[model samples]
Target: MLWVKAFHVIFVISWFAGLCYLPRIFVNLAMEQDGAAYQRLLLMSGKLLRFMSPLSILAVAFGIWTWWFYSFASGPGWHWIHAKLLLVVFLVGYHHVCMRLHKNFVAGRNTKSHTWYRWFNEIPVVLLAGIVILVIVKPF
Candidate 1:
């Protein structure tokens, strides 16, 4: 159970890093006006997808395990659990949005923009802060 908690925490951090950084990368990718920009974005995003996919899988697995295994009796970080779940929903949407962006980048279509991505990247940051607060403070 402690091992489960450890894994859950580690994966959650890694997952959050991936979630945050990928969108930041998209900011640069979005700024490209020509196919070169698209090419760079496609390559970088593809590489990042490969690296982050496994972390996401780990995060989801440990998160579910933590929930189903320890949630009720121990009251184990329920606020964090809830917040992470909400962030996970956002992650799912972000994942699909990344896919959409990937397709567009591969097809030589410009994504949104650095300006758009600057604000866009904050979504995960806000969610991360909420998750961290819930985990640390458990204020609910």
Candidate 2:
């Protein structure tokens, strides 16, 4: 169980790293004016997304295992767990949205500016902070 938890944390960290970095790549993509540079950034985002997808799955799988197998006793103060799960769901949605955005970039149909992507890049940072606080402090 401890091993599972450890790997869960490991995968979650990797997923978060992807969540953080992918948008930065999008920022570059969004700003890129040259066709070659745009294509390169699109390839980079696609590869990064593909790499992160499994880590996201593993993180959630281990989290579900941790909840069901090891820590099912949800009583008072466990609302944080619910909140964390909700945020995780949002994160998963965000990941898929990034994939769609990558597709848009690949099609040369991206309408968003680099500034928008720069702001988008900060979203995962905020969510990561929220999730870490909920998990570590379990503050309801």
Compare the candidates by TM-score and give the number of the best one: 2
Q: lDDT for every model?
A: 0.75, 0.90
Checking candidate 2 for backbone clashes, the offending pairs are none
Estimate the overall C-alpha local distance difference test score of candidate 1.
0.75
For model 1, which pairs clash?
none
- Give the per-residue lDDT of model 2 (tens digit) for 13-127: 9999999999999999878887788788788888999999999999999999999984674888788988988899889999999989988888889999999999998888888
Q: Which portions of model 1 miss their true places by more than 4 Å? A: 35-38, 71-80
Candidate 2: lDDT over CA atoms? 0.90
- TM values, all candidates: 0.82, 0.94
Each model's total of backbone clashes: 0, 0
- Report RMSD for candidate 1: 2.7
Worst 10 residues of 1 by lDDT: 71-80
Predicted structure 1, TM vs. truth: 0.82
